[model samples]
Target: MFGKILIANRGEIVCRVIRTARKLGVRTVAVYSDADVRALHVEMADEAVHIGPSPVGESYLRGDRIIAAALATSAQAIHPGYGFLSENPDFVDQVTAAGLVFIGPSAASIRAMGLKDAAKRLMEKAGVPVVPGYHGEAQEIVLLASKAREVGYPVLIKARAGGGGKGMRRVDHPDDFSEALSGARREAKAAFGDDRVLVEKYVDKPRHIEVQVFGDNFGNAVHLYERDCSAQRRHQKVIEEVPAPGMTPALRKAMTEAAVKAAKAINYSGAGTIEFIADASGGLKPDRFWFMEMNTRLQVEHPVTEMVTGVDLVEWQLRVASGEKLPKTQGEIALAGHAFEARIYAEDAAKGFLPATGMLHHLQFPDAPPQGAAMRIETGVRAGDAISPFYDPMIAKLVVHAKDRTTALGALHDALARTEVAGSTVNMAFLAALAADADFAAGDVDTGLIGRHQDALVAVAAPSDEAIAAAALAATDAGAPGRAADPWSSLAGYAHFHTLARRTRLRFGEENILARVSARPDGRFQVALEAPHDAINSHDLRNLLRTARWPGHVTVFEGAVGYTFAVPDPLAKADEAAAATGSLRAPMPGLVKLVRAAAGDAVIKGQPLLILEAMKMEHTIAAPHDGVIAEIATEGAQVSDGTVLVRFEDGQG
Candidate 1:
């Protein structure tokens, strides 16, 4: 094995590579952007180098800078971990040209499968079952529409050059085809710099099952079973499992063989996944699946596959890249157990699952897996790290394994319920909801599972009456009566020995929790809370505040959501009334891409105003109501959250 290698990536994947490399006695050189100067990956590597600015285009994607860093650090090879330059064939070629090994598939192999349309044609020739679609090189929009018509309704227009759900649009009717194609082409150009697309017949109720395959330089390849990635949101997988639910032994054998065949066709080396879209209505069958795409690198959910296969794919990547054959043949590989992986992302599930960014003030997970369970965590960040906007918003991959699919799912559900994270919004509750979902538990899942049960997925437990009372009382700075901080309880009223009854209502979602609090003999307040149904649950505020321990703030973590109550010193509210209020705010911090309406333009509800790009996605803000635009502040400018872009007469709030 080589003495050192460079990890040409960032976030959790970079950290993942570094760990495996270190275990194999290979020192890792990490390349970071300006935003990641003190990131977890940088701190964990043997050596680190600054590539460029925070933006991926300026840093991680700069092949020349990455190559220079690798050479300067004397790295013998470079591992591009699944994104940025991972599938860039030109970058792979450049790395080999510089006398450094690219720890992935050969550049020729990548080029063969880089474009979706071309790859499908190649698969068909390789005897692998491919989706029935138009893979032809027709550029005319009318011709493409005709092909879609030929393929039947509900055709999928997908970018030929990129993945990660970008530049992909599903049109269910001919009337929506033109507008969707335009949007898909625009996004494809922006993301992959390629406007070329392919039209495919959209498979209804498809289950995403992908096989993990490995090969050596000697043309030997073996498959490591399959992973069911059917639990998805916005076309991106949120949950994945190995030894796919409802998979039959015959189906598994066929998919594995097909995956190995696809690998052999490309002379594929190292770790690659051949993803298949299967019709799961009748359960997995040998003849019911078709090739979707191939991920040319280690997948994010590889841990789940590792748990069931007893294989360390990263170690295999290193061995294959170093001219060694795969450790095992297809006959020797066997699935051991069932495994599940849930992607914990810093995102708001209710607001369309928009990515969130914040400091991780408090992050905690179960110290050990449940008895007889294999709970694994693969993360690049720790407490005190900031979730930056310049990268993917995933916090970690939580994997669980057990003797059976049912047991593994049960363990995953319990694990999610016990996991706690503060200071930032997360999809933990949503993930728990998904695990407990009836269809999901029954292995009846599809791409539309989350969309169909979206409301229940985002339903948070309402704070109980006692919890709300405790939060209100905790918000008051006075300590409990007879405690050190509440010694002046008898003199609270000043004129006489009296108690002040403070009433405060906290709003979460659409429910209002009412609290009536009074200071006791000690500084602590005796609080009583009432819910809408006259249900009362009393909470002792003493322990809740102490356990949360936020800096100058009290956050009551009860039920499903956290309630943030300020412990102000009575003067903080006076300072809030003096601020100006006419600013039209940006809902998120992002770069202003376009300004549709100028000043004084009449705008109606749902009228597009401007576009903002964040976390590799574009969002357009619209007018909340029918109003006349009074001022247009910024156009094509980078702005922070709540930065004003335009102002309207009655929509200022």
Candidate 2:
């Protein structure tokens, strides 16, 4: 193995590479941008280098700067961890020209499968099955529309040069094809600098299964089995598992063979993934799957494969790049157990999975996984780190393995329920629901599972009465349960000193809550909470929700949703009750892409008011009710979360 290597990436992936490098007694060099100055990855590296500004274009994507840093640090190789410059063939060539190894597939292999259209044609030539679509070079809009008509209705318009959901759209009718094509092209140009696209028939029921394969300089290749990534949203993988539930021996053999062929076709070196889109309308069959695309780098879901195969893929990458033969043949590798991986992101699944940015005031997980149990949390941020808008908003990857699929899934569900995050909105509740869903638990999943069951899965728990009482108690004394911070009792209220109940006022959003607490005879406190349109519900003193407090703030977690409440100051102005006003606020920090509605324009509920772009996704802010827009924000302004973008006319609140 080499003495040192530089990781040309950030976030959890950087930290992930370091762990394996340390295991092999190799030092790691980390590159960071302005936003990641205090990032966890920077602190974990043996040596660190500052790149550029926070935006990826200015920092992580600067291949020349990264190469120079590696050369200066005497790194023998550069590891581009799965994103940014990882798939860029030009970067690989640049690294090689600078006398350094790129710890991934060769430049020739990456160029062979860089674009969707070209890769599809190449796969066909290599005798690998590919989806029937228009993979030609005709870029005329009318020609593309005509081809979509030929393919059939409900065709998919995908950017030819990039992955992820950035430049992909699904059109069900001919009338929407033109507009969808335009939008896809715009995003494609913005993301990949290539607006060219291709059309494909949309599979009604599809299961995304991909094979993990590795190659070495000696012309030997092997497969490490397949992973099922059917759980997705907008073309992004959410949950992944190994030994796909309904997979037969014949199906696995066919898939793995085709994957190996695809890898060796380009003389691929190092790690790569061959993704296939399977027709699951009937069932998984030998001929029902076709190559979707090839990820020429280690994937985000690689941990599940490691858990079952008992192999460290990173170590393999280092060894292969250092002129070693294949570590194992196909016959030597075998599956041991079932494994699952769920991506935890700082986003609100209820709001179309819109990404959020904030400080992680309180972040805690269950105790580290036992040695053999293998419940792992792969993360790059600690309790005080912030999730900024400068990069991907993923928080962590939760991995678990067990004797079988059923047991592993059960452990995943329990682990999700135990995760606690207080500062930003997260998708833990949705993940828990998906893990516990009947169809998923039975291994009956498809790409449309999340879209079909989104309403039920994203219904995060609302703060219960007990949660409010717990918040009230946390905000006042700010002490652990069964202990009081001061000698003053709840009975010491009013001018008289005999005995009286204390009323504490708190605010959660527009709702005002009053908690009446009285000290019991046994040195205990009982709380009765009163809210709008409800009786004075008595809270069970014996049971209080888990809470975390910081000075004047309190957050009570209710099944992964943190409900933060603040105690109002008696001397402050009483603005909490001044409601009935109209204001449209930005849900997260973003740039205002477009202003669909103008001032004085009348709009109804759910009508598009403006469009905001954040974290590379577009979010449309709609009117809340029938009202006339009296004021509006600029179309090109960048604003933070909760910034008022529009205000309705008087009495329209």
Residues 1-653, model 1: lDDT tens digits: 98999999998898888888989999999999998999999999999999999989999999999999999999999999988999999999999999999999998898898899999999999999998889888879999999999999899999998788888899999999997897788778878999999999898888889999888899998888888898998888999998777888899889989999999999999999998999877767799999988889888899998898888889999999998888888788778988999999988897778888888777777788966799988888888888887888898889999999889988897677566666667888788889889999998888889999999988876655555565665554333345445455522344355766666655544565566666555444566666353333223542433224355445565433455554444334566544245446766678887678988788778888887777656677888777788877576688876677777765354
TM-scores of all predicted structures: 0.90, 0.93
lDDT of 2 by residue, 94-148 (tens): 9999999999999999999899999999999999999878999989988999999
Off by over 4 Å in 1: 470-525, 529-547, 551-553, 559-569, 573-584, 594-598, 632-635, 651-653
Instruction: Find the 10 residues in a row with the least total lDDT in model 1.
Output: 533-542
Score residue 338 of candidate 2 by CA lDDT: 94
lDDT of each: 0.81, 0.87
Q: What lDDT does candidate 1 reach at residue 228? A: 87
Model 2, which residues run further than 4 Å from truth? 368-372, 478-502, 531-544, 571-583, 595-609, 625-636, 647-653
The TM-score of candidate 1 is: 0.90
**Which one wins on TM-score?**
2
